[model samples]
Target: MKRTVLLLVLLMAAGTASAQVPSPSQPPTPPPMPTPRGEVLYSCPGGIDFASTFSNDGELATLRMPGQPDIELSRAPSGSGFAYSDSYYELRGRGREATLTAAGRSMRCHAAGRPGEPPRTYAGGTLTVTLFPDGTFRLRDRREGAAEPVLDVGQWAQEVEGGVRMVLRGIDNSRRAFRELSVDKLVADDGTELRRTEKTDPIDGKFRLAGMYRDAQDGGLFTACLVGRTYGVAPGGAEPELEKAWVEATPSREASLYVEIIGGFDNNNSITVDRFLTLKRDGACPALVFRGSALRDTEWRLVELDGTRPTFTEWRRRPLMRLDDAGRFTASTGCNTLAGDFVLDPDGLRFVPGPMTLMACPPTEAEIEKSFVEALTAVRTAQISGTTLDLIDATGKRRMRLEARGR
Candidate 1:
């Protein structure tokens, strides 16, 4: 009886479990898949193409293309595609085309070809073009079959006067030719005639110079001069001659005076006055200043006892270096560079020589350097009264005085 009861209980439990379980063939149906969003297709005629899909949150989830490997650009919210082509291309909801042209080449973009659908074409030729979003565009051409250069229209010369007395010369490959084309005659505000003698030649035809003229009514006289085969126009017959004279007569002012030391000093280091020299304006022949140097107690004095003569051995012929209103001075001191500044004072003039790099020179050159430094250093004040410059030291001693040549 106990065994029978246990078997009965087990059978009842198995029957209840089997009744509650559902069959595998009758499972529940799944939810429908979400529709794709965002840009489905973007492409250009020159093989650039792209496609994209978005997630439920409107975020880009996938991007696909042909030829190029697929890329997952969804790190951030992504919904755009990029492609590279010879020319620019873009596609939105509807199909559109953009074309560009330059030189002898043309590029076109069109709707991508599909089964049973004709592909749209955007063709560009020698003309250059720019397309905008509002369906408007700009076109330009240089040569007849090429795109025009991106030059400012203001830079182009245009015909002003009616076809009268104007000449047109065309240039092609650096060769000049005459043409019967319209020429722009530029004129100044004062009614002065301005001529543009340069032009480019037409591609398909031989060029010729065009000449046009108008009646003169109080017009400026125009004279033409022919030298060999070249002709030039001037305002008057004597204009060219006057221009030449003015160019030749322009005065060139000298900036500084160059003084060179010549002759040898005596064994006692006494330099005689007769050996000194001065450079003239001719810049070729040096004038010998007979009394050039005088011997003072220990140092050779640049001035003689008579005080009117400068003593030196010899000086190279050079033009006097000129100075402007400013007191800054620059000059070549025979064998080396010399520069300094000068200040005018009531008593005398002061000269401050900038430091100079020393170089090896002959014995006479060394003496000249020493003397030049001493003369410059001893100046307490300097005055450019008239054409003469008088330098006086602090001890009331007259160091040197220079007179302007030809003054």
Candidate 2:
């Protein structure tokens, strides 16, 4: 009886101790961060926002807008900044600013960064301004689509009441002071507004194309390294300099030298040389051989026939070819199909024609098909440059050109 009574007292004491101890409380949730105003990667004047992400190679950008489905766009040739577009919508961005156009309506946007940050670069109307952390500044004035700057100078700068002041020292040692509206801007004393811009890579702009320059009877030929296009150097201010450099580098009648130049496109098949850079005797395009083995299993579209571009009325009427792992191939001859067996050994290639369908074709298409088959039969080696394929004959002449489809 005494033992039972002691156990009952111990249970009652345990219950009292448990009741006196409080339960552990949960941690308080953190408050959500407030989104800053005017921080729109894709925004409108009324405060609408949108988002976008780019592909790894920067070839595509997908956009997401409020109350709308996602849209994907392919990168297109642009004169400045980055441009992506489709049949319906177009988007262009430079530095931290962007503009989107849809259905003839345009909207401006700002990336997610506060303006007026120090140590920044800004550009507008061919003027580029850069601020340094050591209280120094530089300005460059160059024309659009040109690399060589017309006016370049290092100057002194300091933070002022509203923004920053830049002092320029002329050739006569006379000092001139100017004020910028903001750190993110590059403005002149005359109130020319400059927008923020990022520094570009050496090969990123329209100028600064490095390639191989070969002298030809009709002016010259320039095969760009990264661009992978052979262009006829149009007569311009830099033509005389280019010829001089070529003659100096190689006096031989048949000369092929590497060169760099600042220029823009004259047409689809030629480039106007604005400035000539340098010519190297030992330089070659390294981008050609890097992806040579990538030919197999890829859909190839015929781009050139016997060193000339082939024209087709419709895209579906163009020639197409594909090589398989089993050493066999199939191709489209614009109107019929052709099957064959192929042998690929390192950089060499041989096509053994198997069978082909004889279908009635238009006169122009028939002539193109005849040349195309002849060129393929003459191919003894292949050279690849990114998405381009050049089929060369035993004599080292490029007879046929193909490109990876859908590129």
Candidate 3:
């Protein structure tokens, strides 16, 4: 009788548990969906229109073009507005304006639509620009005959807070080189011109130069890479910090360092280093940086060979080496052109010389060319940093140094 009573109590407890549980028709709640970020279509030079999709945090932009791969650019530092960059491209924008620097080409772009902004005419300095709400623009050269308007139709975008930038598209990309206009003045449709009330700042007569600085016996000598000119430093004209910076940048005596300074040229064509702006330990020229050349498929000119500087020749026809993705390379030996194959593995890099041209050259040129070819064969590894490519021998010594000059 007691065992039966215990069995009935256990059955009653199981029935109470089943009643307390929720029904099968009720399901658990799910998470909320993420809100979508906006997208913008931009019209660029050469009729290249692209679309940029932004992330929710505004830290990433994915660019999409018709025939090209999608590029993901991360947010980079900018003085105003936004900037994004990857290894190959740089995109900058403010308001509805965007500009892309890719493949050694700069193209200005504007977003497709602006709802509140209507078609406005801006005229200044014999040029008239009409910007429409659809982001298309028409620019006319008023300097010519009044009977005909030389129209340049393309895209327009907001450059800054109060400025609008218009880019001209050329037929066959002829006039597309650096052809842009920034209009700050507004001309009403009724022909009334509106100018800014604020006075512009006066221009400063100072100039800035950045290049390699060598502490020579006479004084400090600088080679401006962009202009490819050498200038002597004015004695006692530099700030005390400039000397300190040079000493800090150079680890040993007779070392060449990179420096940037601001000054004006004196009567003797020497620059006075009035202000020291920057000092990098080993920095490449700004020209090469702006060229945007990568390691592979880039033509690199031999600047230093076997711990000696190469003789100056024709600037454009200097000895260069080009490495392709197919493990093949072609190089100019200052006398003969050589074609070769190379190997790149995790262990190191090696070059195997193949066919070469046998050209008669002067004694000095022939000797230099012979040494260059031998140096290539001796290269055991390669190192690339910034705009420089250094070839090293088995002894870990740098045998040759090259700078990226593009194709």
Candidate 4:
């Protein structure tokens, strides 16, 4: 009887505990997966490339490619395609094959390469070979103009797109005598045989010079473009010294090229060609950046010297200096007129004032003019920023400050 009573009490207690417990709740649903989106680089098997971000579903936006501006693209009215003006792009075969003509030329392209794909990253992939009629060729970074060629030389080719030559005369006077680089023997100073592009763009019909470049050893770069068949090179930081230099390019790829050079140099005038490549292309050409002389045609009036304001007793005049492209300087001190011969270069400025007028003047004014001429001779360098120019020495110490007139 006691055992039966205990069992009944335990069952009652279990039932009460079960009733007090709360029921379990269902798990929250996970957020829907983000729409698949990625960057797509559309290319003409061998011609040009266009980049865009796409929503795998259908839409593509931000088409950035060379030879054209950034074009915004949307899904086509019918199937999997996009359009901009007369340029219609039909991306099929999962982006492996497509047709687009925004580059002003219709092209049927394939996935040449992607941004992160090791084979198609910057400075990688199929080497672009540009040949010249003179049996010369350049290894370009890309297909179009504006890319500075990595290497340019007159070549004796063992093989090319089906042609052979010992020496070339692409231009009437284009070849350099006694210099022939075997197509196979071309290499960097450290000697690395460059590889060619693994695949060619289907639209890669011709190559042009358009791009920016710099030598790994140099401090800056230059922008090269062929503006209207006129090849040009514009420097970035310090101006370059160009002598007996001109570039020549052709309308046909591997047919003719603008053969010129953009490389690294130092104070001693030695060239080290390294890290030279091109990318920014314009209309298949280059623009020349030839800064003949900085001081030429520049006119200035002294504002302050050695931190003292101009002070003259009776007859006073503000010192004026004008330099012409021919390396001649004409100046007038507050009291006297002076002429001089001078040289201005990356080195330093040296003014050798020649004969001066001996016109008499007030004692204070004469003293001012004498010291003014002396200051001009001390200019070793110049710090020109817009309208203000500070003449500095080798130590970068400011000696005279002048203001540009009528800039």
For model 3, residues 304-382, the per-residue Cα lDDT tens digits are: 9899997755664467787665778778877567776887654567889776665566677777888888899998877
Using lDDT as the yardstick, the better of models 1 and 4 is 4
Q: What is candidate 2's lDDT per residue for 243-284, written digit by digit as tens?
A: 888988885645568888887655343667888888889887
Give the least accurate 10-residue stretch of model 3, judged by summed lDDT: 27-36
Ranking by TM-score: 2, 3, 4, 1
What would the per-residue lDDT of candidate 1 be over residues 1-407, giving only the tens digit for each residue? 32233234223323201122333332122122123343333222232223444444543334333212223333232122222222221211211222222222322222111211211111123323222121112223345644534211000001111111211111221211122122233333234443332332112211121111111223211110000000121233333343333234323321111211122112331211222133222221121111111000001112221144534455431212222225554433444445556554233345676645344545655555666667677867543322244556676666565533210
- All candidates: TM-score: 0.23, 0.32, 0.31, 0.31
In candidate 4, clashing pairs total 41
Stronger candidate by TM-score (1 vs 3): 3
Cα RMSD, each candidate: 45.4, 32.6, 32.5, 32.2
- For candidate 1, the lDDT comes to 0.29
Best candidate, TM-score-wise?
A: 2
Judge candidate 4 at residue 150 and give its lDDT: 34
Query: TM-score of predicted model 1?
Result: 0.23
